[model samples]
Target: MSNHEDDVVSALKRGADGYLLKDMEPEDLLKALHQAAAGQMVLSETLTPILAASLRENRPSADRDIQQLTPRERDILKLIAQGLPNKLIARRLTITESTVKVHVKHLLKKMKLKSRVEAAVWVLQGKNG
Candidate 1:
């Protein structure tokens, strides 16, 4: 029965993995619980559109912004999006760890992102356009 968007968002931020309405069917609740237990985020159907709209509204201009990245920067970003640490990324790319850090710093600055997690989420969300 909860309809407050802020409440739902707050619960999610506090590590609530699933957000189902009280009125959902028993079978649906069971299904959601199973999904959540499997490490999936389960939002009630009614909340999906709201979340989609929020994502769209907050999404950056990734097409143009991504174009600003150098080829090497883009490679590093793709690896970062894969959840690789700087050291692993450096080893994979055959670059020094310090060089990887420099590239990450410059790319984050150019993309107006503050952290590797944000970069990973941005790319995983297909915000690269």
Candidate 2:
């Protein structure tokens, strides 16, 4: 629904609590709804294999994505995880703030994340290798 490359991927990015197909079994749909209402992340059982295959074929895993970062980008990512602003990161890295901004943009794109917070959280969650 939001601006995204794909609907399923977009939904996941937007923090959808659950993903269910229209053709789901009535009982399973109800159960998924209940689980989501209880603050659980739910995915349709049938969708698991298909989603996994699609992700494996289409998108890099988090570690793979992190491995794709340039050294400068990785440094910036660590700075971001430390909650440093671009100016501070630039000063610490002895790069222009604009250059820091550019690196941030590239890193976000490489990680397929939307914003600095997401990038920070991703790194904090130990995917920043």
Best candidate (score: lDDT): 1
Residue-by-residue lDDT tens digits, candidate 1, 68-118? 999999999998776576778888999999999999889988987656645
**Which candidate's TM-score is highest?**
1
After superposing candidate 1 on the true structure, give the runs of residues whose Cα lies further than 4 Å from its correct spot: 1-59, 62-64
Residue 50 error for model 2, in Å? 26
In angstroms, how far off is 104's CA in candidate 1?
Answer: 0.3
- How does each model score on TM-score? 0.56, 0.52
User: Which ranges in model 2 have alpha carbons more than 4 Å from their true place?
Assistant: 1-64
- Write the residue-wise lDDT of candidate 2 on 27-108 in tens digits: 9889877866654456565554544444556645544467788999999988877667677888899999999989988988
For the record, the alpha-carbon RMSD of candidate 1 to the native fold, in angstroms, is 7.2
Separately for all candidates shown, the number of backbone clashes (residues 3 or more apart, or on different chains) is 0, 0
